[model samples]
Target: MQAFTGSTLYAAIGGLHVGDMLVQLVFFIILLILVKKYAWGPIIGMMQKREEYVANEIEIAEQNRAEAERASKEAAEKLRQTKEDAQKIIEDAKHIGGKQEQEIIESARQEAERIKISAQEEIKTEKEKAIQALQDKVASLSVLIASKVIEKEINAEDQEKLIDEYIKEVGEER
Candidate 1:
């Protein structure tokens, strides 16, 4: 019965006055609004800026990747061209060497032919001179034999008659 009496002591003990509860509720709402305005706005803005910076970095990396690929392709093409040029140069050198070898062989053949012709001409000239010398020697030997035979066998009168007969025989033979 004393506990149930309606007085300041009972009100405090029960914890149920309408005016105090309403005032506490209003203060709590004001504190929530202030925290939203002062603390949450800057944090949201900073997050947005960070997201934009990350996106820009990704784009730059993609561009650099594409440039590197292009440079690599160009280098590969240049290497192929250099190999082709080197092959062509080797082929040209081989062709030139073959042509030079042929030219050398031809020149050697021409020189051999010239030497053969000169040797043949020299042999022919030597043969002609030898034949002429042999004929002259035979004519002089025949003259000497005839003179010795006539001196051993004939008088002056017989020599005169033999000379006349020889002249007649020579004219008939001719």
Candidate 2:
């Protein structure tokens, strides 16, 4: 709305302070140079160190995961092997038990056989003694009958009575 004039625009912004503006500019340039020289390298070094630390941590995590997987696999394999060994031990125990059972049965059977043989031998010996006693009884009976008959003739009834008396005498003596 007003007439265009350079001086009036400059006066509105306080343009006579241009020398102060230049001094402020020079001060800003010096500040920037000082910050770049004194602070930038340490800040960059700190950032690089942080990056390397993070990368190392990630690599360690990966290695730990792999180690854990390998350990788990090894544990599983050991478990399988332990189970197999236990099975083998069970089988061996069963085999030993069976063998012992068989041995015990065989021993019992042999003992029974020995007992039977001993009993048979004893029976045979008893039978022979009984037969000998019978022969002796018969011989004594014959001799007594022959002597009685020679002394006096015996009828059938007398012969029967004599035999009964001899049997009684033999039984009492034994």
Candidate 3:
């Protein structure tokens, strides 16, 4: 090979077809412009839309989670309130039951007292009737003795026989 010089190198490079290079470069620029306008722009826009959709879905999921938590809290509060109400109802029922028991006991006591008082009154009335009957019998017996004494003067033996007969009659009537 001959030693290269700057001028010779320039002549060699210049020997290529400049018009063909210029035409290929222009076509390449046009292809790049078409790709950017028709393919690249749409692809980038689709990607942006996909990103926005994913972000929106995530936000909705977060909101749903918060709503679920709030509902759970509300349910817990309602349960607590229901428990309190149930406890209160039980307490009230117990109080009412105790009051009714006390009333029943008091009523039974009063009834017993009344029964006792009625029995005592009945016994007293029966005793009074027995005493009155005994008094009438004694009065009749005294009148009979007076009439007998007035009818005749009795000796001791006759008096004893009369007494015995009166006793037998009184026993048979009883």
Candidate 4:
């Protein structure tokens, strides 16, 4: 290599110089002061705003989750209530149906008894009418026979005796 020179970097391609180093240091110090005054505070404020926004979103999400849980619990309770109501309605219907069925059966039984009694009464009346008709026919026959016998005898006493005898026969038959 060549001998080291007193001109420093002026004598070499990549060597550092004192004057350039001093100017670089001064420029770096000014740039650092400008960034701290004009850029650093705003950047920090933007970062803080982003952090607050993220926190707010997390809180909202938690509230939504709690609301969803509460709604689900209410729905479960409502379902239980609806089922109970449905069961109560079914029970009431069954009870009403049973009562109605009993009433209908009782009514039918009463109607049947009334019809049976009516039929019995009609039969009794018809039997009495038949007996009366038979009695009338026998009385007429006895009167005619006694009248014919009396005509042959040609006596009032015999006619009355025959009529009494025929009447006694009719009574015996009855």
- TM-score (all chains, Cα) for each model: 0.60, 0.78, 0.70, 0.68
Residue 158 in model 1: lDDT: 73
Global lDDT scores for all candidate models: 0.80, 0.91, 0.90, 0.88
Superposed model 3: Cα runs more than 4 Å off: 1-33, 150-174
Q: Which candidate is the best by TM-score?
A: 2
What is the C-alpha lDDT profile of model 4 across 1-174, one tens digit per residue? 867667754757566777898999999999999998899989999999999999999999999999999999999999999999999999999999999999999999999999999999999999999889877877787678867876796477976887787778767866
Best by lDDT: 2
At residue 97, give the lDDT of candidate 2. Answer: 100
Question: How high is the lDDT of residue 2 in model 4?
Answer: 65
Model 4 segments beyond 4 Å from truth? 1-13, 153-174
RMSD to truth, every model: 10.6, 3.0, 5.2, 6.6
Please tell me which model should have the higher TM-score, number 2 or number 3: 2
Ranking by TM-score: 2, 3, 4, 1
- Candidate 3 residue-wise lDDT, 1-174, digit = tens: 798787676688986566788999999999999999999999999999999999999999999999999999999999999999999999999999999999999999999999999999999999998878767776787688768978999888978887887777677766
* Ten contiguous residues with the weakest lDDT in model 2: 9-18
The list of candidate 2 runs beyond 4 A from truth reads 10-30
